[model samples]
Target: MKPFDFVQPTTTDAALAALAEHSPNVRILCGGTDYVVELKHGEQSPGVVVDISRLEDLKSIELTDAGLRIGAGVTHTEIMAHPLIAEHAPAMIEAAHTVGAVQTRNLGTLGGNLVTCVPSMDSGPVLLALDAQVTILGPKGSRQMDLSEFFVGVRKTALEPDELLLDVIIPTENLGKPAGFIKFGLRKGQALALVNAASAFRVEDGKFKDVRIALGAVAPVVMRASKAEAVLEGQAVSQDLIDEAAKIAVGEAKPIDDFRASKEYRNSLIEVGTRRTLQAALEAANG
Candidate 1:
């Protein structure tokens, strides 16, 4: 790791001031899961490293009038073990389990993962399917946007150099919304997802309602497969309808031929993933 000045700010205002002072030379340190690896690889060497990991206000998981407020500094381990999350949105816990091994999960933050904006991030698909929003803090105060808009591209985000991700919020209406997340990696642990997908919907009068299908790794960003969602919306539940919807999902992703998997293989996985998540979510809703 390159030598750098370190600052541990106790308040958001202090962190903002430090960021403004350092401006482009500052890197906000959250969980150090991705950043530490980057530091060792010489990917970044900021002049000032602002450690926001100690910010108590940013390390929480609770319910608010708005919905579930998951602080940016909350670790994956916390998410996995939170009883409120298990009762209200277990799909999040399911996704968190696929993030990494026990060690990484202990140190990684959900906001940090989303802020990194990697295409294959395990935390994204389920959140996207659930219509999650992200809040960013900077010198100007706070700005909130859809998680999709927050992602710019590979390893890039809409955040400016002086900005910090605050948290991810799943709207109250979506609480207990039947959602499912699926990830296909080379191995069970410490493997990057070849193709990951999530689905959420309601079964109203035995028909699908407000269906959402999100996919990752196969696209530049975690993307909603609207075409597939359209196929299921208002449609009666059936294996045939789900199979058809899954087939449409394959057309929405832009998978590439790489060493991890071929384009054809990814397409097959996308179909299977879409179907399985939808079925799982439907079961959750029924229960």
Candidate 2:
């Protein structure tokens, strides 16, 4: 790894100050599960590395008036074990479990996973389905945006050079919303997703309400399958309707032909994944 000036900030304010002082020449380091690998591979050469792993402010998981506030520094393992997460967003735990293995889960932060902005990231689909939002802190102060808006493209986000992701919030309305996540990978473990999907909705008077379907690994960035969602929204919940929506979801994605899988194969997975996740969500809503 290239040598760089390292500053371990004990507070979020200190971390933001370091980022502002260094500006575009600096990078933030939290769980380092992804950034450290980038450094070792010579993909990143920042003049200054501000380590925010020690900042207690970014390690909390609390329920605020706005919603469930999950600190950016919270690890996959922590998310899987947290009562609030399990109680409010259980599908997130399922997604967190699929991220690499125990070792990677131990060190990979939720913010790091999202900040990496990989189209196949395990964390993105579930969060998107639940309508999560991200908070960012910079020299100018803090700002919040929908998770869909936070993602810009493959390996890119809306975060600025001197900004730090603060936390992710699943709005109060989405808390405990019936949701399901499914990932199709080349292997059972430590494999990147070829197609991943999540579905969330509420059942009211035997009809689907506020339905959301999100797909990943089949586009430049994780995206909602809006047409598919439109198919089910406000409709009577039934297996036939879910099957129709899943088929529509396949048409909405733009999967690429890659050595790992063909575009055709990905399209098929998208359909199956959407169907299964929706079924799972339906079951949750029923109970």
Candidate 3:
């Protein structure tokens, strides 16, 4: 790894000032799951590494009147094990399990994963399905944005060079919203997703309400299959409707041909994925 100056700031104000001082030379260090690998490969040799990993202010998972508040630094392991998450937002736990192995899970932060903005990122689909939001801190103070807007492109985000992500929030209305996430990868463990999908909705009086379906690794970013969701909203709940919704979802994605999987195969996965998650989410709603 290339040598770099390291700074560990304990407060957000200090961190912001340090970032301004270091400017383009500074890079924030969270869980280090991706950044460390980049350093070892000589891909990024930043002049300064600000270890925000030690910022205790960023480590929390709580519930508020607005919804479930997850500190950006919360680890995947924590998300999988937290009682509040398991009971109120279990789809999130399902997504967390599909990330890297135990060692990486213990060290990787949700903020880091979202900030990386990889197309197949496991933490994305479920949140997108739930219409999550994010909080960011900067010299201008703080601002909140939808998770969709926070992601700009592959391995990129809407955060400015001097901004730091603070937390992720699932809106109060969506808490415990029935949702499901699935991924089709080369293997059960340590494999990047070839295609992944999630669906969320409520079953009210045998009809679908607020239906949402999201797909990953098939577009520039994790995106909602709005065309498919539109087909299901207000529709009578049934297996046949789900199947049709799945077909529509496949039409919404633009999967690519890659060594991991063919575009045709990914399209197939998108259909099956959409159908299965919808089924699972409906079951959750019924319970």
| Model 3, global lDDT | 0.92
Once model 2 is optimally superposed onto the true structure by TM-score, how far is the C-alpha of residue 97 displaced, in angstroms? 0.3
Look at candidate 2 and tell me the lDDT of residue 177. 100
TM-score for each candidate, following the candidate numbering: 0.98, 0.99, 0.98
CA displacement after TM-score superposition, residue 103 of candidate 2 (Å): 0.7
Best by TM-score: 2
Query: lDDT score, residue 245, model 1?
Result: 95
Clash count for each candidate, listed in order shown: 0, 0, 0
Task: Give, for candidate 3, the lowest lDDT window spanning 10 residues.
Answer: 36-45
Q: How far is 73's C-alpha from truth in model 2 (Å)?
A: 0.2
After superposition, the stretches of candidate 2 with alpha carbons farther than 4 Å from their true spots are none
* lDDT string, candidate 2, 1-23, tens digits: 98899999898999999999999
